[model samples]
Target: MKFRKKVDKVLGTSLAIIMGVMVINVLWQVFTRFVMGAPSSFTDELARYLMIWVGVLGAAYISGKRMHVAIDLLPSRLNKEGQTKLKTFVNWVIIIFCLAAFVIGGLRLVYITFTLRQSSPALQIPLAVVYSVIPVSGILIIYYKLSDIINKEL
Candidate 1:
């Protein structure tokens, strides 16, 4: 649990870096696209990938911090106790789904990448790089969700 606390701190820092990078890269892309009339070949794709990491990694931090948006349209019916139960159930479901995709879907993606030897059109970067992020994010999300549940119970 102590180690997890440290990990949460590290992840929090990563969240900040990811956000800054995504924002800066997107702004630069916009500038280059509109002002220079020549967007960098890889900026768009890179920004997209960065956004993916930002979103996925941010999910973990948000989950850990209990910062995710939850609409309680029926707040009277779904009080805090109900919300807590629902969140726990949702987190469990998320853990299951994410683990499945990371283990099964990730392997398939890796296999496809190696088999086809596909790369990005502009950057010629290995396509596996993008797909690999999916599994990584899944793993992180699972870890964070479980940690949150455990910490909450404790």
Candidate 2:
């Protein structure tokens, strides 16, 4: 419970900060392009990178909160035990998918990007740095799913 709360706080803060930066960057891009007759190339690239982080982090945060969109129709009608079992099964499936696809695949991508020394064209930031969010968020999702399973009332 305590760990979940802490994770939630950190993730929420990170999302908020990144979203704020993205908003500002977009506004600046607009202002410079239209009013100043000059466009900031870096802002667009930075905003795109920030959006990727925000999306993955936001997903992890939602997983922690068990707020991800789901079809609750059947579960809602089921008995407590049935509902618990259904939720557990679904959670396990999600965990497995995250492990296989996000953690494993994302790590592979990160390694490739790092080895190739790939960098964003506009910002010159390492692509690996941006791609790192995938595995990190996958780990976070696993943590939250385990926490949810353990703390479930049913």
lDDT of each: 0.78, 0.91
Query: Backbone collision count in every prediction?
Result: 0, 0
Give the per-residue lDDT of model 2 (tens digit) for 14-51: 99999999999999999999999999889989988999
TM-score against native, each model: 0.74, 0.96
Q: What is the per-residue lDDT of model 1 for residues 61-146, given as tens digits with 9 covering 90 to 100?
A: 77666677877565547868887788788789878998887756886896799689999887788888777767776777778788
Q: What lDDT is reached at residue 1 by model 1? A: 77
Off by over 4 Å in 2: none
| CA RMSD (A), model 2 | 1.1
Query: Once model 2 is optimally superposed onto the true structure by TM-score, how far is the C-alpha of residue 3 displaced, in angstroms?
Result: 1.3
